[model samples]
Target: MIAARSLFRAGAAGVMALCVALAVPAVAGAQPYPSKAIQIVTSVGPGSNFDQLGRVFAERLRQKLGVPVVLENATGGQGLVATRRVLNAKSDGYTLLLTSSGLATMPAIVKNAGYKAEDFVAVAPLGQVPFILYASSSVPATDIASFMSYLKSNAANLNMGLLTTSHITTMLARKFGKVVGGELVEIGYRSSPETLSALLANDIQMVATTHAIAGQHVALGKIKAIGVVADERTQAVPDLPTFKEMGYPTLVINVWEALFAKADVPKDVLDKIRAVSREIVSDPSYLTAMVPTGMEPWRIPFDSLQSVIDEEAKAFKKDADELKISFD
Candidate 1:
């Protein structure tokens, strides 16, 4: 009887041990997410607008989450490198990607972008940066019409530089080419910094670049703004004429960025991120800090982000189809 009792005790102990082991993970998972460091990967080189924004936002996020938030600059392949990294990461709330809308929409233009818009979900809508078509001061044209005329005549001599050949910069450049009845030599740089350097050195005669890069150059008279590809004149350069005002309404375009994570991330974690982002963007201090950089907040709730992306994608597809823009 004692031997049987001892065996019963042993079996009970084993069952209890298994139950504890099984319950440990459930208990652990119930603990608040982000019990560890978080990483925000940017799809641009250091010193670019996205990189700067990522650093600033990471600092704020760290404060909000009580965890160390770090930035990783994953440059190259027009953001394909960073996108792939984020996609492959675990769906846990630790890893995130801050990249431009181009990452979602570029596949509409490039056949082999390697990812789709549905693979990721937007956690926050950061801001939009108006793009400007800039020409070296040596160019005779001072406005979009005159510039297009010049491009038509100097098509063989002038080339346009862009941060990436697969982005809106290239889209606008190709549109200009089609409108002028001539093709401009399109050169792709890895980032805005490289494109700006090339443009200033006259390595490329024309460029589609952001206000953060071309604004100071325009002020210094080192480069001329052919047109701002936005719906309205920006506060940074209120005197500049938008493409719409310049008679080419179809050329108006702006590049925007957003925070993203894998689609399967926990809803509660996603909500927490969205709440923090809304707070960050709504803060006056954050707005002021971003003003000099010419970025404007584009706030949208988390639930609405995917629809916005889908709408944007539809427009991009329409334009790409019309332009016959295919990397293949």
Candidate 2:
């Protein structure tokens, strides 16, 4: 009888051990989201306004999310590579895309952007960086009026440097040429810094670039800002008037940086991210850091992001169609 009882007790212990082993996987799988590091991808290279803004926000997000936030610069295919990378990544909110207003122009210009603006869910806005039309010091112009006249006179020989064909700056540059009644030859460069360098070297007569990229050159009188492409003049270049104010109201284009995740990312995870983003953008330190970069805090509410993207994409498509611009 004692031997039989010992065998039954040992069998019961074995059953309990098996049950615990079976439960371990379930417990591990149920752990909260973001158990690992998150990556933010952008098409721009390092030291860009996008990179600077993204890095600052990433640090704050890391602090808030209690996980490492890594920034990866994919930089190719006119942002198609980075866009597709985030689009194809797992929809667990671990991978994200940090992009600019130029994203809206992708579908309008690129025949196969692989994803539409709506395919990604908007997480948060970083800031708005206004585009400024800049001319090399070699150009015989100081302001928009004089610049237009000079462009008309030198239209046959002038070249306008474009950062990328799909960028808003390119669209604005094309439009500016049309408005000035001149076909400024388009020269493409790999990055804003490169574009600005070409402008400074007089390789290109004009370029529409961000103040962050061209402000120092303007300060040293190496290049002159013709006009801003925002709705209003920016404090960073208070003396410079906007294109709108300069009688070209249709030339306004403001580049905004924002975060996006795969559209199917779990709503709960997105909610957590948006909440933290709201906190970070509102922080005083964050605002102060962006000032010198000519970025202004411009937050789009979580719910309004899709409509804004849709509207912007539609507008860009219309413009591209009118301009007969297409990469394909």
By TM-score, the best candidate is 2
Task: Report the C-alpha lDDT of model 2 over 1-328, residue by residue, as the tens digit.
Answer: 9999999999999999999999999987886867899999997788877788889999999999899999999988888889999888899999999988767668778887788877887789888877788988888888888887777788878888886634676687668777877677989887777888898889998888878778888889899988988887776778889879878888888678899889899999998899899899988999998876567777677679768877888888898888777786
What C-alpha lDDT values do all the predictions have?
0.81, 0.83
| Runs with alpha carbons beyond 4 Å of true place in candidate 1 | 1-25, 149-157, 201-203, 292-294, 299-303
* Pairs in clash, predicted candidate 1: none
Local accuracy of candidate 1 as per-residue lDDT tens digits, 1-328: 9999999999999999999999999987776877899998888778767667767778888888899999998877767889989888999979999998777777787767787888888888777777778998779999888887888888878888965534677778778777777788888887677888888999999987778777798889998988888877666677888888878878777677789988889999988888998888778887777765567766566678888888878988888788776664
Model 2 has an lDDT value of 0.83
TM-score, candidate 2, is 0.86
In model 1, the Cα lDDT at residue 136 comes to 89
RMSD of 1: 3.6
Worst 10 residues of 2 by lDDT: 163-172
Candidate 1 structure lDDT: 0.81
Cα-based lDDT at residue 288, candidate 2: 93
